[model samples]
Target: MDSYTSAAVDGHLLTPVTRKPPLRSSADRHGPISKLGDDLLVAILIRLPNARSAFLCKSVCKRWSSLISTSAAVSFITVNRAGSTTAANNLL
Candidate 1:
C-alpha cells in the first residue's frame, strides 16, 4: 500500500497530525447545526424522542435557547411536518 496521500505519513513512522478541525465555513465557526435555519433546526429538534429532550437542547447555546424558547415556531412547523393526526398530536 504505497501512495502519496496525507503528508502525515513520513516513511512508516506515524507522526502526530496537527490539523485544525474541519470548519463549516470561514465566517461561521459554531458548528454544522448552527449554520441551519430555524425551520431546519426545528425539524431536527422535533426528532429528539420527546419535547422535554428537545427543549433541554436549548442549553447548548444562545441560538438554540432563542429558537427553542419560541414554541410556536417549532410546534407549528413540527405539526405540519408530522402530516398525520396521531403524529401531530404526539408532538404535544
Candidate 2:
C-alpha cells in the first residue's frame, strides 16, 4: 500500500462508502404474472373466449397493451377478421 494510503487508513481519515440496494414496491410482492414470457402472454391472450374479450383485455394493463394490441389480439383469435383503418397519431 502507498504510504499516504496506509497513514490515512491508520488515522481513519477515509471512511468506507456504504451503498444501499434499491427498494422494491408492494407490486413486486405478489404480481408474478408480469414475469410471464412474451410468448406465454401472447398465447394466453390468443385463447380468450372471443375476439371481443381479447380486444378488451388489451387495455387491461400497460404491459398487456405492449404485449398485445387490441386488433392484433382480435386478429390472432379470428384469423379471417377484416382489417381496420390505421389509428391517427396522438398530438399534444
Candidate 3:
C-alpha cells in the first residue's frame, strides 16, 4: 500500500504532500492601504504633520476621500491644528 501510494491514479502513486509555505504579511501582499478599516486608517492619517498632506491623501481614491471628508476626521484635524497653535504660543 505504501509503495502504491506514490503511484499515479492509473497505476502510479505520487509523492506525499508537503507542508504549505509560510503566509505573507498583509503589507507584503501589495494590497492597497485602504483595505484597512476606516477608523484605523484615519488614526494613521491623523498623525501627518501637515493638513495639506492629509488633504492630498484624500484625492488618492474614493474611499480615502470619503474617509477624510467624514466629520470625525475633519474635527480631528481641526483639533490637531488648534493644539499645535496652542503649543507654539506656549513656546513664545
Candidate 4:
C-alpha cells in the first residue's frame, strides 16, 4: 500500500517500519519474561491507575496469572500504590 494511504487509513499517523524484538522470546535464556521482570513488572503494575496488570498478564499464561494473584504480590502492589489498605479505610 502507498505510504499516504497507510498513514491515513488508521486514525494514528504511520511512520516507517522499524525492527524490534518481540515482547517474549523463547530463544533468550531469560525468555520472553525478560522484557519486564517480576520486580520491574510489579513496580509498573502498581503505578497504573488500578490493578490493570492482573488483567493484562492473564492472557500471557496460566503461570503468570497465578503469580500476580498471590497474596504477597497483591499486597506488595497494593502497598506500593498508596500505602496499606488501612490508610484507605481511614480516609473513607
TM-score of 1: 0.50
Residue by residue across 4-81, what tens digits does model 2's lDDT show? 444376557764567998878645853888777665666665555556766677677786776566556445556522
Specify the poorest-scoring 10-residue window by lDDT in model 3.
Answer: 82-91
What would you estimate as the lDDT of candidate 1? 0.63
The residue-level lDDT of candidate 1 at 53 comes to 72
Clashes of each: 0, 0, 6, 1
lDDT by residue for model 1 over 1-92, one digit each (tens)?
A: 35445655645654455898786663276756667776666666765665677667879888788888886855754554433344444544
**Local distance difference test, per candidate?**
0.63, 0.56, 0.67, 0.60
Residue 74, model 4: lDDT of 75
**Which tens-of-lDDT digit does each residue in 1-92 have in candidate 4?**
56655645557776778898666554375565655656656665566555665547657665567767889877766665633344334333
Clashing pairs in 4: 24-32
lDDT of 3 by residue, 1-92 (tens): 55644447666557776899899875566476737776566666656687777888887778789888888787776566423544333323
The ten-residue window of minimal lDDT in model 2 covers 83-92
Please report the candidate that would top lDDT against the real structure.
Answer: 3
Runs in model 1 deviating more than 4 A are 1-27, 74-92
lDDT, residue 24, model 1: 62
